[model samples]
Target: MSPLNSTFFINDDIVHPDFFFISGLAGIPHTNYYYIFLGFVYAVTVLGNTFVMFMIYSDHCLHSPKYIVVFNLALSDLCGSTAVIPQVIDTFLFKSHLISFEACLTNMYFVLGFLTMQSFTLTLLSYDRCVAICFPLRYNDLVTHKSILLIIAILWMIAGMAILIAVMFISTLSFCKSTVVNSYFCDHGPIYLMACNDNTPSAVIRWTHPVLILWLPVPFITGTYICIARALLKIAASERLKAMKTCTSHLILVSVFYFPLCFTFALASIIHRNARIINLSLSTVMPPMLNPIIYSLKTEEFTESIKKLYRRTMIHITVRKK
Candidate 1:
C-alpha cells in the first residue's frame, strides 16, 4: 500500500478521522514568502535570546536574583524556539507533510515540554519577585540560589513527565498519510487530525493539557505581582520606588510572555481549523521572537549594559586604529 493509503501498523481495523483544516490547507497553493517571514522570526528568537544569555553570563553586575531569572527565561525561550523552528523551517522549505510518526511525536514532545517549562519558570520568577519586594526580610531565605536550582529541577522534571504522558498517548495513534498539516509546524492539533484511528484520547490530552500548562499559573503569578505592587505603594517612598523599579522589567516580561500564551492556548481546539492555523502560528512564533526584546530593551539595566558593551567595542576599535 502507498504510505498515504496504508493500513495502520497497530490496528488495521480503524480509519483515522479526517481533520478538516489539513484537508482545506492541502488545497491552498504553497508559497515561499511565508517561509521567508518565518525565517526572520526564527532568527530573531535565536539571536535575541542568545544575546540575553550572553549578557547574563558575561556581566558580573547582573549576578542577582532578577537577572538570574531573566537568564533562565532566556534559556527557556531559546530551547522552546529551537525545539520547533527546525521542523517549522523544514516544512516551509519543503512544503511536505511527510514527517514520520515517530518524528511527529518527538517534535510534539519537546515543543510542549519546553513551553510548559517556560510557563512554570515564569511563574516561579514572579513569586520570587513578590517575595523579594513585599517581604524583603525573608526573600533571601526564600529565593536563594539553592532554592532556584531546586525549582528549576522540578520544572524540568514536571514538564518532561507531562509531555511524555501526552506524547506516549499520541505515539500510539496511527496516521495514514492524509498528512497535510495546516500550520507551519507539527503541533499536536494538526498531527492528531492526520491519524487514521479514533484520536479522541489524544484530542483530550492535546486540548486539556494546555490549561494546566499555560492558564493555571497565570493568575497565581500575576496576582502575586499585583499584590506586591500594592504593598509597595504603602511603603517608605525611597524603598518603595527602588523595589518597584527593580521589579518593573520583570512584571512587564511576565505580562508579555503569559498574556498572549494564555489567550492562544485557551483556544487550542479552535486553532486546528484552517481559518485559525495561520493566526495560531503567528501567535506562537511572535512571542518567542518578541520576548527577549521586550525584556532586554525595555529594562533600564539591560539597555545600559548594551550601551556599555557598544562603547567598549568602539574603544577597542579606536585603539586598534592607533
Candidate 2:
C-alpha cells in the first residue's frame, strides 16, 4: 500500500485513520495520560460551561449586553466541547472508536458551526469594547439589548450558512479507498489526509475557511483593540488605568485565541501531514480550554457568585445535620 493509504488503529479502535502515522508528537500515545487528563478536562469543561450558563440565567446582575454575549459564548463552548469530548472519553474508556460515517459528519457540522460562531462573537466583543472605550458617548446607544440580539442572530445565521456550504463541498468528494482518520476525532486535518480524490476542494477549504473564519475577524478585532488602547492612553492617567484594568484581560484573550488559530489553519493546506497535525490540534484545543478561564475567572462577579453559592449550600448542609 502507498504510505498515504496505509493506516494503523490504536488497539483496533475505529478512529480517525490518518492520525495513525502523524509525526511531531501528535499521534504519540498517552494511553494512561489522556485517560486521566482528558477525564479531568472533560469534567471541568462540562461543569464550568454549565455553571456559566446557570450564572447567566440566574443572576439579575448579568443581564447587560456584555453579559448576554458572554452567556451566548458559554453556550457555544458547551455545545462545541460536548460534541467532541464525549467521543474522546468513550474512546479512552470503552475502547470503542468505531465512529460511523454519518456520525462523523454530524460531529464535523456541530464543531464547525460553533467554532465559526465563536469567531464572530469574539469580533463582536472587540467592537463592543472599542465603542465602549473610544466612543463612550454612544456606547450604550450603540450596544443596546435589542441591537445585541440582532447581531447575535446574524452571527448564528452566518455561521450556519458557512458550515452548510463547506460541508456540502466536502460531501461531494468521495472517501473511496481510504476511510481511516488518525486523530482523536474527525478533525478536518485527519480527514484531508485520508481523502482519495484530487483534494482541490479541500485545498480551497483550507484557504477560504481560515480567511472566512479567522483572518477576516482577527484584523477587525486587533485594529479595534489597538485603537481603543491608543485612545485610552491619551486620556488622564487615572482614566487610562481604569480602562486598562477593564479591557486588558480581554485583549490578552483575543490575542491568545485568534492569532495562533489564524496562523495554524491558514497554513494547514501546506503541511497537514502527521507532524503538522500535533501543532494544529494543540492550537485548536487550547482556545476552548482557556476562553472560560480568561472571561469568568477574571470577573469578580462570577467569582463572588460562586463563593456565595458554595457558602449557601454549606449552610443548608449544616442545618440539615442538626
Candidate 3:
C-alpha cells in the first residue's frame, strides 16, 4: 500500500459510496487536546466576528461604502467558521465520521464557497484602497454604498456558482475504490483523488480552485499595493504615511489568510497528514478570529465606533442604576 492511501480505504468496490469516513489526527497522541483547542478557536471566531458585525450595523458613521465591504467580510468569516469548525468537532472528536453523500456535497459547498467569497471580498477591498489612494477626488463617486453592495452580491453569486459546479462534478464521480477521506473533513482533494474512475474534471477543479481563491487574489493585492505605493510617492511624507497606515490591517489580514495555505500546498506531499491538517485548519479559522481584532485595533473609524458604543453602554447602565 502506498503511504498516501489509507489502509481501510484501499480495497473498496462501491460504485457510489453512500458515506465517507473522515480520517485525520487519529494516530496522534493527545488528539483530544487538539479538538479542545479547536473549540476555543471557534468560540473566539464567533464572538469577534459577531461584534464586528454589530459595530457596523449600529453605528451610523459606519454606514458608508467601505464599511459595507467590511460587513461582507465579517459575514463571510462568521459563516465560513460556523460551517467548518462544528463539522470538524463532530467528525473527529465525537467519532461521527460517516458523512452521507448529500451532506458531503453540502459541506463542500459552504466551506469552499465562503472561502472563495473571502478572497473575492479582500480583492474588492484592495480595489477600494486603490481608488481612495489613486483618485481621492473621485472616491465618493467611484465607490458608493449601492455600487459596493452590488459588487459584493455579484461576487457571492459567482463564488456560489463556481462551488456548486464543483460539487455537482463530485456527484458524478464514482468512488468505487475508496470511502475513507483522509483529511480533517470532506476536503475536495482527498475525496476526488480516491475515485476509481478518471477524475480528470475534478483534478482540473482541484488546481483551478486554489488559483481562483489564492493565486489570483494575492497577485492582484500585491499589484494594488504597488499602485498605491506609486500614488503615495507623489504625495508629501505625512500624507503618504497616513494613507499607508490605512493599509496596515489589510496587509496583515492577507498574510494570515494566505501564507499558511501557500506553505501547505508547497509542502503537501512531503509533510505528514496531521501537519497538513493543522496548517489547513489554521489557514481556515485563524483569519476569521484575527480579522475583526485587526480591524478594530488598526482602523481609526472602527476604533472610534467602539468607544462610542462603550460610552453609550455605560450611560445606559448609569440611567438604569438611578
Q: Per-residue lDDT for 1-322 in model 1, tens only? A: 2334533344555333232122323444554676688888899999999999898788788777767777888888888888876666665465444666556667778888877877887788778878887888888787887778777888789888988888877666766566555555567776776676778888898766677666678778768977897988889999888777767776776666666666665675565465465555665567777878887767788888888899999999999999
Among these predictions, the greatest TM-score belongs to 3
Which segments of candidate 3 are over 4 A away from where they belong? 1-14
Q: What would the TM-scores of all predictions be?
A: 0.83, 0.81, 0.94
TM-score of 1: 0.83
Model 3 alpha-carbon miss at residue 61, Å: 0.3
Clashing pairs in 3: none
292: Cα error in model 3, Å? 0.8
Stretches of candidate 2 exceeding 4 Å from the true structure: 1-27, 189-199, 266-275, 304-322
In candidate 1, list every pair of residues with a backbone clash: 15-196, 16-196, 16-197
Ranking by TM-score: 3, 1, 2
lDDT of 3 by residue, 1-322 (tens): 3223323322244356667777765666898998898899889989999999999999999998988999999999999999999999998789887887779889989999999999999899999999999999999999998899899989999999999888887887877556777787778988889877778999999998999888899899999999999999999999999999999988888888888988998899999888898889889989999999999999999999999999999999999999
Clashes of 2: 11
Q: How accurate is candidate 1 locally (lDDT)?
A: 0.72
Report the CA-based lDDT of candidate 2 relative to the real structure: 0.70
Cα lDDT of model 2 by residue, 107-212, tens digit: 7788778877877877888888898899999989899999999999999998888777766655555554556566666665557656565667776775676776
Q: What lDDT does candidate 3 reach at residue 163? A: 92
